[model samples]
Target: MPSRQKKVIFCIAGLLSFGCALSVAVAIGTQFWVKGTILCKTGAQLVNATGPELDKFVGEISYGLFHGQRVKQCGLGGRPFQFSFFPDLLEAIPASIHVSVILFSAVVIIFSLVAAAFFMYNAFGNPYETLHGPLGLYLWNFISCSCGCLVMILFASEVKLHRLSEKIANYKEGNFVYKTHSEEFDRSFWIILFCFTVHFLNILLIRVSGIQFPFQESKETDTSTGAADLMY
Candidate 1:
């Protein structure tokens, strides 16, 4: 590729990485990761709430990594409440898994910024063959991608396997048990997924900038040597 074309590709990749970092940062601070309805199982059963009557016992729940909001309904009215994860609900939730998800999310943001900086450096500044160059780009992108994957997987496990929504709904409620009625990953969760995809695309952009994948050149050289030995 021409120098100008390579510069353009690097700039685009860098911009994309920076954008992803910003998006993930915003997602981490927002309460849009999971959104669902929780049904007050005890209340529903007590009143034999069937058909449309069950709606009276269902309320909304939405949460992110650090904090969230829930509306509790037990056939009376929706009662809104705000919650935090650090100290408030630690005893009720899977603190370890939840913390791991947050840690990986931070890693993704940090590495994404590093990748963007490296991309810009390769584009404009003089870059060496190893850490300061294409190899470093690949390393940073791979790390970001891996961390992003871990964030999604860990968070999903915390939500599904641990029954996060239900736990939050029933927290401190001794008389009524709450069950998840419907749940879906919201905007913030999808932003992380999109961020992961963007990093993968950056890897391809690096390839388009004329940098061979790590070890690919070495494998090609070894193949050429073996063919030459046979010819000899």
Candidate 2:
């Protein structure tokens, strides 16, 4: 590849990495990872609240990794109450799984930043053999891709397969009772997924910048050797 093309590719990859890191950080901090409505199962039945009256029995819930808000419709025109995950709802499975998700997201962000640094160094600076060469680009991008994929898969499994929203809503304490009416992974979840896709696309960008795939080159070399021996 031409020097100009390589520079362009590196710049694009670096910008993408920065975007992914920023998005993951925002997702971690925002209390919008999941959003849904919860119903006061016991209170609704007791008051026979149905139809539009059921709106009075409905509550909105939105949460992230650390803290969230729950607005109860039954009281004070749906006043929102804040809650934290640790020490308050640590016993819940969703909370535990989300803790793992947050950890993996951090890993993804770190790896992405590292990859971006490598891209910039290779583009402009004098790249050394191991950490700033083509091999370094492949290694860093691979790690970033793997970490991003793990973040997406683990969080998706927790939300979809494990029924995270329902579990959190069903958690009870003393006289308080809540049941999940409907739940969905919100913007943060999709943003994380977009980050994953971007990292994966970076892998393709690395190849497009004239770096040969490592295993493919090895296979080609072995095949050439075999053909030469047969000729002999």
Candidate 3:
């Protein structure tokens, strides 16, 4: 790749990583500002003013992270699906949003793989460009690991707000309360973090998403020439 083209690709890589980081940061920061109050039902309403204040912050955070766009809600209502997102954005949607999220997620994954493959194909043959060979696979490794940070931020937001936890724990008990957040997905954030960690480390071992190829040239395959080694 020419230096100019390399610069453009690098910019794309930076944008991809930065955008994801921004999403995580916005969500967590919003959660810290506005986690809702824990109101004990059938007993006494906790009069802590901080409760509503916290809730407002959390609500804003959820809205911002989910982007107020209609997406599929977890199981419920019509066709086993309905509109869903952070509680604050639920009103923004109607009918069904569950199908939308699945479709969006699929697109993101497919494009992500395509981008990764592009990076891999270039990085393989040329040691200078192959991220692992010379440009440094560790840099891309850092990008992959950052996804885990996203999950941590999510968990912290929820942990700060105990309301979600209380609801799940109370499932066995007859007393049930409506949750502003979805327990199913948020609850598994930590597990996802674990997967990210393992995959990130695994990349270092296998070298970039298992892109294993001939690293050392055999005597018969040697193509090195003095001129080709010259730097651009």
Best by TM-score: 1
What number of backbone clashes does candidate 2 have, counting pairs of residues 3 or more apart or in separate chains? 0
What tens-digit string does per-residue lDDT give for candidate 2 at 20-55?
Answer: 889889889998888999887777888888888888
Worst 10 residues of 3 by lDDT: 72-81
In order, candidate lDDTs are 0.95, 0.82, 0.37
Q: In angstroms, how far off is 196's CA in candidate 2?
A: 0.8
Superposed by TM-score, candidate 3 places the C-alpha of residue 93 at a distance from the truth, in angstroms, of 16
Candidate 3 overall Cα lDDT vs. reference?
A: 0.37
Error of 2 at 126 (Å): 3.2
TM-score ranking, best first: 1, 2, 3
Give the TM-score (vs. native) of candidate 1.
0.95
Write model 1 residue lDDT over 1-232, tens digit each, in one string: 9999999999999999999999999999999999999999999999999999999999999999999999999999999999999899999999999999988999999999999999999999999988888889999999999999999999998999999999998889989999999999999999999999999999999998788998996798799999999999
Models, CA RMSD each: 2.1, 2.5, 14.5
Per-residue lDDT tens digits for candidate 3, residues 1-232, read 4544554454444345344334433333232222232223322223332544333212111222232211212122111112124453333333133234233333333333433443454434444544444334444444446545544554444434444334322234354232344233332343335434543553444343333434432332355554456643
Residue 9 in candidate 1, Cα distance off native in Å? 0.5
Query: Candidate 2: which stretches are off by over 4 Å?
Result: 94-96, 128-131, 170-172, 221-232
